[model samples]
Target chain A: MTGWISEFMNHPATYLKIGWLQISVSNLLVILLMLATFALAVFLPFPKGHDDTQEPRT
Target chain B: MSEMWTAKLRTKWQKELPIEKLLPDDQPAYVASWIYVFGVLTLSALAMIIASGIVLAFEGPAWYHTSDAGKFTNSMHFWSVQLFFVFMVIHLWGKFWMAAWRGNRFRTWATGAVAFISSIATAFTGYLVQTNFDSQWISFEAKDGFNSMGVGAFFNVTNLGQMLLLHVAFLPLILGVLTVVHVLMVRKRGVVPPIDAEPALSNRGPQ
Candidate 1:
């Protein structure tokens, strides 16, 4: 279990070193992508006046 | 109390969601698309995850990993989370390709996206509390990212107690509230029509 798990964890880890910082490509990419997703979702301008659907009547 | 606030709240809700629209026995013809079902599937998975998680929380991790009943409940929780992510991802992609944000539905779209992010955060805390090598490694690795962002002091991923509290308490609460709001927004706004969808006969002229 230890051998295989360790090997798998070590195998795909593409590490980066910037000064004293150490990180993996996968981790960095995930963080960047999540931030971008949040930014786009929050900051994107709504395309107004395109709504033609009738409002739900009470 | 005069019940004024309660009466006003009920009136507002009724104004936004009348009986037929709130609990409709029917949907538009276009609702036949399979892609639309993913949202409900994700909701079902979330419900299962929450129920299973409650049981596991009562049992604690010791029983969860050791006892047969606990193992079964834990498996249910794990698989439900997997199903939740699977259904949610498909739902997200479907919305993207369909441009489900059209028709002044940006709030509905934004809520879903925010819910997705919240779910990921909850899942990360869930991983941190697993009490295994995987969890330890994950926490160690994630701590660096948090520290880099100056959030590690507040959000210590390596602390099992904190992670467990976050997983079973605060994070789940946030996720649950976000999910409820997301569903309510969807129901209130109604689904956006498909791109290039023709206007209804009522909107145009009698067919």
Candidate 2:
């Protein structure tokens, strides 16, 4: 188990290590892009009529 | 008894989704948003993924990595999956802030969420069954995560045959079923009105 751990820790796939957090470049890119996508989706403005409220229906 | 149940089911579905609404020619004006396109894009990509996956399955993993037809099908599957995730994430994010759960459409929203989760599982299994060094690394890496959550023993990412079966059959089955249910629910309960839009006559579901 220790040998496996040591080998994995040394693997090229383990691209990022900041203190304890470990992730590959591909994984980090996915995370970052998803965050950016969510932010864009939230910040984008709705079309005119869609943004306006009306009185409750009878 | 079966006849009675079938009749009831028929009535319920008809009530929930009348023929015209099920295949409407026009959507509400608010649906003009380009963001709305991602849902259909995601579905289209899913269809492509399944088509390519079927071809790959017919060829088997050895052929998939070696033969020209198999390689093309594999590439199609890969790209389709990439588009599926790209479009699905945008769709999910758009719907989240849109408060798509409004107007008693919680079930519709919930199904979408469940389908997203299932798709992730399907993709993970797909990665594991690739029979490549990437799969080896990922399975080894993912094992610790799953074990920490106490599910590694059951899931067994390193088991090639199990992962292959899961990728080709079980996980895809779950994802497909969940996606179908999610779409049917969306059709049954029309797109939620924008939070600020008037409770228009065109809005089909309960307020």
Candidate that would win on lDDT: 2
Per-residue lDDT of model 2, residues B116-141, tens digit only: 99899899999998888989999999
Q: Per-residue lDDT for B50 in model 2?
A: 95
Deviation of model 2 at A27, angstroms: 5.6
Number of backbone collisions per candidate? 0, 0
Clashing pairs in 1: none
| Whole-structure CA lDDT of model 1 | 0.79
How many Å off is the CA of A14 in candidate 1?
13
Candidate 1 lDDT over residue span B1-207, tens digit each: 257999888887888877766676666555556667778999999999999998888888899998889888988999899778877887787788777766566777888898899899899899899888989999999999999999988999998999999889998888888888888777776765666674442133111
lDDT of 2 by residue, A2-57 (tens): 68878766656648889998888878988798778666655577556432234466
- Model 2 accuracy (lDDT, Cα): 0.83
On TM-score, the candidate that comes out on top is 2
